[model samples]
Target: MSKSLRTLLNEIAACRHCVDNPDGTSLPHDPNPVLRADKSARIAICGQAPGTRVHSSGVPFTDPSGDRLRDWMGVSEEQFYDVQRIAIIPMGFCFPGLDEKGGDLPPRRECARLWHARLFPHLTRLDLILLVGNYAQKWHLGKERKSTLTETVRNWRQYLEMREGPGYMPLPHPSWRNNSWIKKNSWFEKDVLPRLKVEIKKRL
Candidate 1:
């Protein structure tokens, strides 16, 4: 890693807000809540918070969701993991504890507030940004998004229609919870996926 990136990694690894229940209390490990990026990357993938597996590994997208994401992007493990080609900065860097409804909780509010601007400048070569999940789309595309997550993703072509530099493309989170939504939104299967794969191929 470059000196700057290595320094940033040390800072992230040393964080302890949510991770250091040092008093042995009932609280959880919610450390620094977002990922950092290298300065020369070309493509950026923005997702939600880290899941349990990702947190444990200290590597972004190291779980099933990541597997599905690679498939959607038509890339292999090596390609996906290549920081020079792709950059991943989820909304939440640390694991966001858990939800009462049986899934991981939403990313902490403070993380995005603190890190996004810092991370954006480093991505000088970013050609495209794949905004995965509603949180990412809402924050990046804002009112340009459609009525719902499914609609917003289905209308991905609309964002592409903008044909601008920030070349934003909205996508559903690859988590299994979205299976039903994907089924209902077949246009995504018929239209978006193929186009997404094509764009990824072109960029990579």
Candidate 2:
């Protein structure tokens, strides 16, 4: 028999591989792995690792970016947070630390390598996975994704039409820094967000 989701979450919370056994330099700070999920959920939001604010708050998406994401999905805070309906899992469960310029580094490779294969199988009800940003898209879409983030996101319809397992929808990170990108990509707001909102409502 397989271990329960609760058991897997416990192991993830206590993980120290990034520190005790690092690929390069150990994590700059102690790990506080963060993620949310429930086996009944039909939707998953997979983004990059936590930023400074989220690391401090101990909650995923506790910032403006989260606000934007909620808006994109056309869901309120209460709906977005209900784990029974939606799961918020990042590529990295912890804050991977910042660079010299004060920007966050990429999500640790170990997270997916160690946990995703185990964790995802347990989310038996998942029907839609929203891959937020390049890292999530890269990992989830693999070779099927286009060369550029814009291209992959622009070609979003094909991903939704996928006949295999869960349907994937690629999205740009909701960070304010990408306000310019969002402005330039008018089609996303005009086309993709409407479809996203409909999907979210159907699942809810």
Candidate 3:
């Protein structure tokens, strides 16, 4: 029999591979794998790695970006953080440190490669997955993904229809940095958000 989702999550919580053995070298800082899930969850929020604030807080989506994400999902803070209702997993579980330009570095490839496949099969209750940001879209959608984030997200209906079971919806990162992107894409608010809310409501 397969390991229970709770067991896998415990393993994830204890993971220190990223810090202790990243490419055979130590990380710049300690590893704090920040993710949460439960077997009862029907919705999965697959996002990028933890940002500094999230890493420090050890909670996923605990910043302004999280606030925007909750607003976009039409969920309150309580609903968003309720692991029994929603699973919060990122492409990289830990912070990968900052880049030279002072922005967050790309998620370390190891976490997903090591954990996602193991974790996904056990989440049999999932009804919908919110693929937030480019990394998540690329990982989950593979060749099916459109060339650009805009195209992929614009074609959200296609992905939702393609899956016979758990529906997939691609969304942009809710960071303040993407405020302009959100402004430019008026249809995202007008068209996608309503559909997203409907789906979320079904699962909830």
Candidate 4:
């Protein structure tokens, strides 16, 4: 009756809505939606849109930020990229281009609006979802999200406890740009990471 996960993924791969028509209009550049998933995955990484390296590689989190994320999750590159173990989805499927400040633009809203509900239902085994960055936190947590990123992440335990199905954990983006934020938040390394690793190990 329902399409298989592979079928849905193939449809996602072929999607051109963001480039062909955005906001019921058009995108400035070609679309290159990047993501990975499998029904057996136990963990989901909901991040922001792809960056330059990720866009070029067509692999989500194939950059320094991924290095740090793996470190935080206590997973190696091999384990992190194993689609059977983890699903890597972003708020925006494609890179949303650059902003005037030279930073990557915010994720295109159309992506989640169109794909997440369809995709997530198929990840039948997911036990935990790591919400990385502001966009993901806002979308997933809504009014439950704290006023600030730092506060939301600091309060990860609340979300984890309140989850109905797959437990949710808010995390700051692992981008090198947030080096100062990591340094300033010593408790994250001391407290949150240990819990995150334990949960990951249990699911794996």
Number of the top candidate by TM-score?
Answer: 2
Clashing pairs in 1: 18-29, 18-30, 19-30, 33-93, 33-94, 34-93
Q: Model 2, poorest ten-residue lDDT window?
A: 1-10
Q: Give the least accurate 10-residue stretch of model 3, judged by summed lDDT.
A: 1-10
Candidate 3 Cα misplacement greater than 4 A, ranges = 1-3, 24-26
Candidate lDDT scores, in order, read 0.78, 0.94, 0.90, 0.90
- Kindly report which residue pairs in candidate 2 clash with one another: none
TM-score of every model versus the real structure:
0.87, 0.98, 0.95, 0.95
Candidate 4 lDDT for residue 95: 88
In candidate 3, what are the lDDT values of residues 1-204, reduced to their tens digit?
235766787888888887777865455688899988777899999999999999899999989999888988989999998988999989999998897899998889888999999988877898789999999999999999999999999999998887467879999999999889999999999999999998998888
- Taking the tens digit of each residue's C-alpha lDDT, what string does model 4 give over 1-204? 136888888898889997777785465678888999888899999999998888899998888899889999999889998999999999999888887798998899999999999999999888899999999999999999999999999999999988488889999999889999989999999999999999988887
- Give the C-alpha miss distance for residue 167 in model 3, angstroms: 0.9
Q: What RMSD value applies to candidate 1? A: 3.4
Residue runs of model 4 more than 4 Å from their true location after superposition: 1-3
Off by over 4 Å in 1: 1-9, 17-27, 30-36, 161-164
> Per-residue CA lDDT of candidate 1, range 11-111, in tens?
66665644443333323754744464766777899999888887777788888888999998999999888887888888867777786877887776555
Among the numbered candidates, top lDDT falls to 2
